[model samples]
Target: MNDYVRGSAWRVPVTACQPRPLSAFLSRNAQRRPASAIRSLLPLEQEPGMISLLAGKPNPATFPIEEIAVKVRLPDDASSPVVVAVTGDRLQKALQYGPTAGTPALVDWLAQLTSSLHGRPLPAQSSDSTKPWQLAVGNGSQDLIVKAFEVILDSGDTALLQSPTYPGVLPALCVGQVNTVAVESDEAGIRADALERMLARWDVDEKTSSLARPKLLYMVPTASNPTGTSTSLDRKRALLRLARKYDFLLFEDDPYYHLSFEEATPSLFALDGQDSDHDQGRVLRFESLSKVMSAGLRIGFVAGPSVLVDAINKYTATSHLQVSGVSQCVAIAVLEQMGHRGFLQHAARTADFYRRRRDAFERIAHEILRAEPPVAEWTSPGGGMFLWLRLLLPLNANTAEGDSFALISTQARRAGVLAVPGVAFLASSGGTSTYVRVSFSLIGEEDTAEAFRRLRRVILDL
Candidate 1:
């Protein structure tokens, strides 16, 4: 194996391995799935001067509403609100059943947005058989995540996941019965040395010898859900090298990408493009408008090699058919109104909002929990809505760490404060943790300090 200098932006040469065909990575069920009959006929509607009877799409003429107007609040000026109208042709397109891929205009808009944001150029239109990088919108980042798993994994396939990961994916992994291995993490997120040791000794190690090597690595690099830890740029580059060296695909679940309080690090998807030797197959980045825009809109997009995206779309064709057309239209309207620069400005403001909340919450936490002997310790999050706190409770006889499950689910709730027990985020079964995840996002500003006080009182009472 070749070694690359740490902290450098330089790319390491991957082992001389022939790229496998896209079909080889697909599950058995995906291989046999047929294209939707109605979706196939959608193209004929596009032909110029072609007036036709197609599938049972509703006529927009019969729809009730004349127009839909959205009042967008400008971050700079609260009094001066901009109203974006989605009416006439645009409204018609939204109301009717559309293609499985997503609304064309919205899709195009996001493709450009993603390309520009990530610094990866859109693949040129070509007749070549090999698929290049592209984007596909979904119901939300969660929807895309499930579909990405469906596209790649079969029953019993192993996946390497960061410990204390997002709980959302856990249910899906459970239902699929996929073998999940927990990779160790530090304050900077997944530790490179731990991951390297795991992979280096996978076949030989007694603990992993019985299991197959992981085909995928699922991670939330920015403001990781329960941990609220952001991986550094150097750490990201190191992980990308591991993915290439081990030949496993990376699922970059980065819904909080825009919520970073500090300068954003280049994403794995962006880094894949920077390398001259690589073809952007190593990372599938999932992004959502949920955090920045409206979660109810349920609009998210995944960008990566087209082969992987094509597979994801195949699953979407049967599952949701497409993201809600109305939602897509709404997203397009807002994005176009904001434009790229304005969209980024809004993101910065959103980040600032959370940063203030984090500061307020942490101040109270320090006053209440970090007193004499210090009942709790936590890393101040750089971004996202969560603050992960590890309590210094008495250690259990069976486990090295004290458990927070009872304290959170029972005591905290009884104290009129609620939080997710850190155990919920653990990737493996029977895991124990002394940590709890608290959200600073939804809590009222006035109640923020009191919530921590309540939590601290509960801990003290215990």
Candidate 2:
């Protein structure tokens, strides 16, 4: 027999390799691309101070608005509610449908804010476009994340998520049927070595082989969701280098960027030089005004290659038109009032407040509850709202044998203290966990002591 015929004898039918019509593909394939009306215009607007014949932007003059005042006392020494004002034509633009990507002024201000905060310049466009790496606002960071995932993950396509990640991303990926590869995280966030190993042996790894190649790696680089770990600068460089070597996208879900405990760690985006090398479309950084400001405001944005952003905006336009103009207006007003330094000061106060709470809780966990020779271990969050704790139970906690799910849900609730279970954070079923996630952002100082006391009792009983 001919070599080709003999080799092909063991192969499946040739129809498997035959090209099929687009109509035959799965529903996700039909809906794989991004949808955003506003995100598309980002390129045209980038025409470096170009005038508009393209955008149907409502003139600010036509918009009817005078001022929007947010009543909240500034942190620091300020003693009264600082009513930030949004006046003039700027207020009008904010109140109207405006642009799909975002209001020009707001996007500009955000780009500048990101640059100043991260110590990187605004991304330079490949071609001398008026706009470079611009901004597109969403209801919150979650909004942008859903949109971004839609743009990249197809049905059955793969994504890499750090194990014990934010619970929010779970449902979104599930609804889309995207296969998630859980990469274990160390105290330093998503393990760079694990990521590289997985990618290198994709075909060989039994866990990864049946799935499609992963097109994106999702991570919260600063104060990661459940672990409260941040990737070091060296790790960032290594991750970036590996992404370049492999050509997959890096979804940097960094809403807590400002809340980092390390005041001076380098941001992944800043290391990519504000994404000047669009080829490294490798890093797509997501930010939000939620955790730092107010979660109710529902404002967040993504910065990366124009191509990807445009895809996302396509999904946005077809669905939401644009994020609420009213929210955009309010956010722009607040940002303009705060500028860069004032904003940083406010953020620093918020971060410091959470840090203090973390310190207090850790001390109590060590002193009172752990006094009986310790029953749990936890990583100290540098900056962010949560402290992830791993309980040492006599039973098999990893398999949920002695997991805290029932303890916190039933016993702890009865005890008047509540927390999220570690199983909720685990992406897979078989993986064992003895961990529990606690949020310090919403809890008050007076309640903290009692809460830990209640938590201690549950562990002792277990």
TM-score for each of the candidates: 0.94, 0.83
Let me know the TM-score candidate 1 reaches against the reference structure.
0.94
Top-lDDT candidate index: 1
Runs of candidate 2 exceeding 4 Å displacement: 1-67, 72-77, 80-82, 123-132, 274-278, 397-401
For candidate 1, which ten residues in a row score worst on lDDT?
Answer: 4-13
Q: Pick the candidate with the highest TM-score.
A: 1
Worst 10-residue stretch by lDDT in candidate 2? 1-10
Q: Write the per-residue lDDT of candidate 2 for residues 50-157, one digit (tens) a residue.
A: 886765666666545667778655554457767877766666656766566777777888888887766666766444233345567777888888888876666666
Count clashing residue pairs per candidate.
0, 23
Cα shift from native, residue 31, model 2 (Å): 7.8
For candidate 1, write residues 63-116 as lDDT tens digits.
997778899976667579999889988888888888777888888888888888
